[model samples]
Target chain A: MPAGASTRAGSILAKPDHRYAAVSILPSVLVVFAVVIYPLIYAVMMSFRDSRMGVLGGFIGLANYARLFSDVEFRLAIVRTLVLTVIAVALVIVISLGVAMVVNERFRGSSFIKLALLLPYALPGTLSALIWRWMYDPSYGILNAVLYHTGFIKEYVTFTGDPRTAMGAIILAHVWKFVPYSAFLFVAGLSSIPPGLYEAARIDGASSLTIFRKITLPLLAPAMQLALIVQTVFAVLYHFGLVYIITGGGPGRATTTLPWYVYSETFRFMQFGRGSAAAVVLALIMLVFIYVYLVALSPKERTVS
Target chain B: MRRQDTISGRRRRKAVWLALMTVLIGMYLLFPLVWMALSSFQDERVLQSRPPRVLLTPDIFTLDHYNFLLTGRMPETGIMVQAMYTMSGTYVLPSVVNSLVIAVTVTLGNLILGIPAAHAFARVRFRGNRTLFMALFATRLLPALSIVVPMFIIVSRIGLLDTKLALMVIYLAITLPFTLWLLRGYFAHVPRELEEAARVDGAGRFTVLWRIVLPVAKPGLIASAVFAFMLSYGEFPFALILTQSLASRTMPALMAGIGYYGSSRGMVAAASVLSFAPPLVLAALFRRQLIDGLTQRFE
Candidate 1:
């Protein structure tokens, strides 16, 4: 009976006291709430009301959102943003993977080449965009000059000026800026694979292509997913500098993305309410993507750790 | 002898392939930068000349554009007097100073605050830690555009508007989540046995952290600081909207205005090269640490 009572006491002692953990995490929680959560809530509240650049104009539930669907420019902006995000993310993944594979191979000056590739990412995005803007200038730009001299084309290509090439130019800029980052991540992922696994596969008569497809691809999924998610969020919200400098969402509004659209509304048009509403929608869409991505990943990557 | 010849031939073929690949990738990456540097020295007449010249020689160099920019004068409109007034009155120098001050301060601030937070999250597991850590990671996932307007209001209401402190605080908001998440991962990877051994030798928590954890996590800390500085330095929209005067503007914003108004392309290129200096220097100095910090996994 005494032994049984001792075991009962041990069971009681084993229960976790959560208060200490709560206190330790409290400060971080509060910081996040104040900076991230509070602003998020405020954004949502402002979206429902007619607020103008930090001033409370009035309450108008769903009216701003309704106006968004009705506005032709805003609708077009959504479509354009989706297309840009998809294409840019896809190209960045493919090109970066290709670069990573080459860099992973043992070669002379690989590190130097990798560093050069990452140079644009290290520089400020705004500055890089501005540099490219000069490079894309119609008459004096090096790009047009190169193409003209090479006879790649008979005339100077108005990359950012023409609607057909505007989105493509912006996408190229995004890819160039981010591919190095994705490549770096992939290289890290590749390094983690054990040589033993490859040896075992080779013993089984696996070809190089089959080995990559069967082993490397599965193992690198986590890194790829991480890159894709982060790049998607970044690409979706990739305004403020590049778009502001390169196209300013111009060439007849062909390049106006959701973030650029919000900027134009709040700063240019002074339509804060509508802009806030659009921001709300964009955030919600991003949240949905994150949610779906997490759910999709959980089962497949259960053993990631 | 026949076998040796075959092996040598194969080795030569492989060497050639590797060399070719490296050169192609190198050119692909470096051409734009090379072009920029070349154009910066070229004459304006040459810049406008048909069939533009890609090569730069000493004969093609000129300082006219550089002189124009430094004097705050536009050659097309004779607007030096007006431009100077704008530059001085708008606080361009102050803005650049403010950006540097805020970025440095925030980097230091996050280092101090973030290190402890990361330590606690990594080592001192108490309760609800997983959820709390997840919450911290979630903050980074939120869209910046969604929060910019609200953050503006928050900063304004707190009486921090138009101050470098405002930019610093906002930057901390944007950068802290990332710092905490990244450092926590780094800290978790640090073997706890070392800290435990130090503790057994009568070391306190702070001593154990300083001697054991800090030394091991040096690469991560340096990389995090570099990233923090980059974020704060390059941030434009927040700087543009939060701070009105030229005194509060950051370098990128200053460069933006320069690019928008400058007549000659050489000045813009010069400004671009100048603006890229700080980040490049930091990157080059801590390149190995930066690479390891970014590529290493800690889960």
Candidate 2:
């Protein structure tokens, strides 16, 4: 809210029944606290105990944390997750920038294109993964049929069935769902770049490329920051639904990200302590990411204007 | 004349390039869903054939998939687990109903909890206001996996597992904070003069808010409602954890269960289409509102 609007609104609505205000706010406050704070503390405690098969055992004190370092599967899962996150985030930002750039221009059928882009963002990750899984199906998938028909390969290729393509498959699906959101944000960012600057640059004989590099890019920093934050959360940090649907961390754990590892550890391996420990570590890692991203993107991220 | 021609030529090339890119982006985004929709109508054998037919013809397509989904009659899917999948296929509509109920309940929960809370945050000056707002939304920043273990245990201990109530409660928590964010932004911006005018006419606070504020805040309400609905509808992990069967399972969970068993590609595609319909419709209808709400701060 602008300061003017808020102040104006506040002036008339001053002390609008503080009791009513508190009563209304209390439900959301209580829910958030009870649901989040309690579970978070419990997760911390479970990380210390030797819980297996959903059974709580004696306290094990940092053993679960220590084990995260030495366990090769866990280590590999972290590495795979980082690789996927880094690559996916890069693609999401760049592609969304391209998308936003194009969509910002009022060309024929641009409105349709804009709506098309948002369709994927609106689709569920699991459903999106299922669609891609069909596309990647070895014998029956359209991808294989297309590649074979086009003479890209002599034989149909196994996408998710093969270790090499599984990571790429999930990444593609993940990126597909993620890019539109950032694209829409970037379109807003692009239009928000006052048109006068563009006219001025044009009069000054700046090339399109130069104008983009100079005026457009710097101005897009806020949207870029937002895209980065959202992508990191959905693409790398929290989203396991895509992987869960498409691969289930299979084909030799080729697509196993850390989030998947948490599910795998708890359910498949039945090591609740380790899974909780992994969860705790994942939270800590997320904190570091939030910290670094905020610190790096800071002040600018807050001020959209 | 040559300089003018050169500049015109450059502009033409740029326009063509943009046009090409626009079409490609459209195809890239829409292809998978379109393919899934078209493929669902194909015969199982036709769908499974090596270098499967991409286009549908009268000879190739069948309504068996739709028949099985819309009605309880089994399609002639030759899998040995026909009985199982048929039973499971019947679950799709019911699970969809489950999703609708839960999502609707979650949306209502969001509005009921969100409106007043957002109003307070934006208007009512209180101690710890900013702090509470931040803390409420803090969980959104982290992965659900972090706290899901304890949440899972808590749900089970309370014996709410495999129940829709568990999902409804969790989703309310998950969605309310974000709804609060959007609604607060909205309520803060509602014109105060109208409410004051109502007050001058001798209306109470609740009545003023009801009569004056709500109508003005309708856009915010719609946006928040749609946001909560979409999130609740598409949510996966908790649905996977909490729901045991069609009794409380959502569309995504049911689809996942089918995928796990390696169900027929044609039928799975059919299931995907059925499941995608609701959100797809919602997205198509509320695309403007959803986008505007999400990018509210952008302007």
Candidate 3:
């Protein structure tokens, strides 16, 4: 055959393969765009208009955002959300690190202990919160019962009834559900640390605490950062089922996080625009927080990669 | 002698600290679960007793609560059993089935779609592939609430509202990205030389994937599937927002309605225990896989 004929044949053969690849990936891309991107744009649009489900009354740009800022409950919800996220994420890190260390040590029944600790994570959040709710029930709860029995309190401690304790209760519930996940990450980090480092430290007469502070903490930074980012997002987005099951964001909206607030505004009050604005604010907050952390950790991730 | 004494003393102190920490953690983790089980067997009057009695031992337990839950009426309260029966009959069992069906279907769907997509991303280095994978990962950063309203509208318009299919589709959205990203890492870790040798032996790409790549990546695949299953089983927001009927309601939603919104302590506890059983069993069976799935490389 002539060179021109051969080139034409090669091009014809490659056309089908290129088309096949494009066809193969198209469904997934379309699904993601429909489910993820379109919603995001819709949400942004909704935030700017006086809209309900099908009622787009008028466009009022930034009015919803302004109302969100001025709304007392919304502002309080933001503050409460931050407090919940920080407290829950911080406690999870500390406690899960401790659990991971214990589980990491060479011991019998370690696997069982780890599995037991992880049970809360596997259970539905609502179920776990409900169980905790039962335990926090002032009238019949085991917590108050135990406290009173132990002479720690003369009166019953209303864990979810008192404002001060309501937030703490939710935080405790969040930590319980998430600690195992964090511990799982920490264990991975711990295992990645070569045993030789610990041996060398011991030979250098380093105490366990010293080894942990100098060697383990630094080595575990990546895992810690991942856990921090993930947990912060989860904490901020604490949903209705758990909060509703426990205290319904009360003893007076004490436990109403951003996600719960969005639910109430959209579903309860039927204020779709205001709700979308709150959701947008929430997304921006998460984006800003995660962006700062990513920037801070970029050099480290690059080095590791 | 003095140095020896100091070293022994230090070792003893560390042991004591470890023991104390272990006990505290054990109590914190186990007490609530144990209390729930115990409380489920207590009489309603005993539950409301001013001084809450320790019902830890089985001797103090009454079958009344369990009987009430199973029979749909608490004889002591004289409350009509209709609400309880309606909830259990209308909501509880169907929701469990809904959750299981949705979870299994979504897990299978993710495996089917994600594995191929992951393979394409990992092995077939086509144009814009890196950008595609990053975009997929970034999709996860979008909050579930952000998309839920759109999904609600989409489902309603498509006439899938209050349907298991809607729940399944929503779950697929949530699980697919992580599935693709995680499986891509696993696929990439499989040695390219093996595939190359298979091709040398006249095996096609599909044949190499089936015979060589898949068997090597079995652990990672199992881990991914388990993670998908666990996530689907425990998911709430989509289920709550999408499904309204008994036939489509999920376990988490049912539990929320019964335990939190409604007043059925014993039945809720029973339902919770039952709801928790499947995931706990799965986690037990694939505990190692779960850890690996979460922390393993995403390269």
Clashing pairs in 3: none
- Please give the distance, in angstroms, between residue B172's alpha carbon in candidate 3 and its true position after superposition: 0.2
Better of 1 and 2 by lDDT: 2
Per-residue accuracy of model 3 over B180-293 as CA lDDT, tens digit each: 877888888898999889878978666777899889888778888987887888887777788776666788877776754345565666667667778888878887777676
For model 2, what is the alpha-carbon lDDT of residue A229? Answer: 81
How displaced is residue B178 in candidate 3, in Å?
1.7
Per-model TM values vs. the true structure: 0.89, 0.93, 0.90
After superposing candidate 2 on the true structure, give the runs of residues whose Cα lies further than 4 Å from its correct spot: A1-17, A300-305, B1-8, B76-86, B196-204, B260-262, B297-299
Residue A234, model 2: lDDT of: 80
Give the per-residue lDDT of model 3 (tens digit) for A35-129.
77877888888899987654656999999899899999999998988888788899999998988888777454456557667677777787888
Q: Candidate 3: lDDT of B4?
A: 100
Global lDDT scores for all candidate models: 0.75, 0.81, 0.75
DockQ of 2: 0.59
Error of 2 at B236 (Å): 0.7
True lDDT of residue B154, candidate 3: 74
lDDT of 1 at B143: 69
